[model samples]
Target: MDQKTILVAFGGASPEHEVSVITSHQAIAALQESNYSITPLYLTKNGRWLTGETLLDLKNFEDLKKLEDSCTPCTFGQNEFGQPVLLEQKTGFFSKPKTTPIFAVIDGFHGSKGENGAFQGACEMFNIPCTGSGVMGSAIGMDKVMAKTICRANEIPVAESVDFFEPDWVDHQSTLITKIESLEYPVIVKPVHLGSSIGVEVVMNQESLIRAVEAAFKYDDHLLVETVITPLMEINCSVLGSSRAQRTSVCERPIGKEELLSFQDKYLNDAEAKGMASADREIPAKIPDELTKAIQETSVKVFKLLSCSGLARLDFLVNEETHQFYFNEINTIPGSFSFYLWKESGISFTDLLLELIDIAVEDQNQKARRIQSYDTNLLSQKAVKGIKGLKSKK
Candidate 1:
């Protein structure tokens, strides 16, 4: 069998671009290089795409000008067989065109175009299998408000939230403020279309709410304000598989110094400070067994409810005083793919990647089974009639 070439796409037009680069590098290192051919596709912050041997090195990213010069610019297209093809610049004038089949797209995109459905839609347009959630799932996952609504409809427990679009906030600031004040103090303000806690802010009072909203508005037009669950303990659980068949990995408790997990605390903090290596998480969460079970069960429920595929990490906030657990968010394409949690469940990173690839292929096959085009062409029948005959109906 020919070795399948996988496009490991990383870096994106997101605040978490640098983080995506690190995650992609980790994935590339874990992949079984002997079994599959890897293609490093780098997406710049400006949205330009490039690919080359130089991208395989992490240091190349430090120097943007040198990195751009070393890599060949590329774009996505379809092949003759109707498969997704990657078009790369030819090295020499006499050389034949170089293209490769994008067997799978390993998405490391964090926000907007990456976490949202843009890349997923592109994959669907070309009928290619890509890792992570499908278009609808990706879009819903990126929007916290939408995810909460869907979860609520499915009887899943989520925090109460009020959403405000840009126009609504601009036109009815008073109305928006009234709605927000009703929620409670220390409400969490978030950019509706971001991930990895990029534009998340915890507002302690009306004054802080205004400042947080102003900061969050810089990132997205849509915003979400939800009552903060104080005395909170953060627990994250990773789910693997599709909606039809899925399993949950061991739960992890993120030990952060702050009341809420900040972007820096989640990603930048050393693991030793909180215990555990790589990202500071306690495997199987030190919480009561009942709480652990509840979190795991809820994780699976949310994954299936969202129609998430491959893998996703669901975050939860447990109020220490009340012992009430509330859904925070779901990361369809989680950073580091939440391998640490899965690792405790006896799944290695390499095995996890293989499993994700298998799930993607199965999803694509199922989609292929669906009937798309009819045997008879409606256009042909229309052409048989005269132009005047068609114009008569109009």
Candidate 2:
């Protein structure tokens, strides 16, 4: 049998651009040992879509300018047979552009449009199978305020937070500050729609709180200020499969330098080649088995509530003293695809990726079974004539 082409799509105009590159490279390396043919779909910071063999190499990313210059500019389109293809341009006058059929798309993106359903919408338009959460799930997972609200409504414990847009802050600065202060000092401020700890800040006092909020607005229009959960222990669990049938991986306790985990702690500190998998964390987190069971169960609940599919890592903040935890955030297209957690759960990295592809294909097949359109034409000449005749009688 011929090898199927799995388009490993990543990189975007977000703060997590470099991280996404690392993730895509990681996925490509694992898939290389598999039966499927890997195709690199690199989206530059400026939003240019390109693909080529050069993108599959991790070393090329060190100097992105030269690397992008070596890639072939491409876009999503269909071939003569209406099958989805990655169309690339040719410079020569007589040479026609090349077209490669896409069997599926591996959503390896980290933040921004890549993980927030925009890219998923593109895949749906092109009628191609893409991994990870669908549009609704991706969009909600990316928005912190929305995710919290939904979880709260579902009786899931979430830290109390005060959310406001940039305009709300600008117009009612004092009022917003007062409301946040009610949550008390030393709160966690976050950009509502960003991840990788890009604009997350732990503010102790009012002065610091104002500064943090201001800084966070630079990355996103909306911000969330939640009461700090000190004596805090950050535990994360990865959920696999779809909303219909899902399972949670072993819980992990991530170590941080300060009260909160910074971006440096997650990817910059000991990161070598594994991306998020390189982050310092304790697998089968040193918590009671009972607590671990609770967290794992909660993780699966949030995964299904958010309508997530493929794989997602759910972060939770636990009170070290009380052993109580609150659902934090969800990484729809988690960095390194959260293969590290799955590895500890008895699934290898390659196997995890293969599972993601299988889930994507299954999702696409299920969608195909749905009734999409009607058999009768509402815009037919007979229909139009009847409508005109009725109008005349009226």
* lDDT, residue 194, model 1: 86
For lDDT, the strongest prediction is: 2
Q: Give RMSD (Å) of candidate 2 vs. truth.
A: 2.0
Query: Judged by TM-score, which candidate is best?
Result: 2
Q: Per-candidate TM vs. native?
A: 0.93, 0.96
Per-residue lDDT for 331 in model 1? Answer: 93
The stretch of ten residues in a row with the least summed lDDT in candidate 2 is 269-278
Name every residue pair that clashes in candidate 2. Answer: none
| CA shift of 275, model 2, Å | 1.4
lDDT of each: 0.84, 0.91
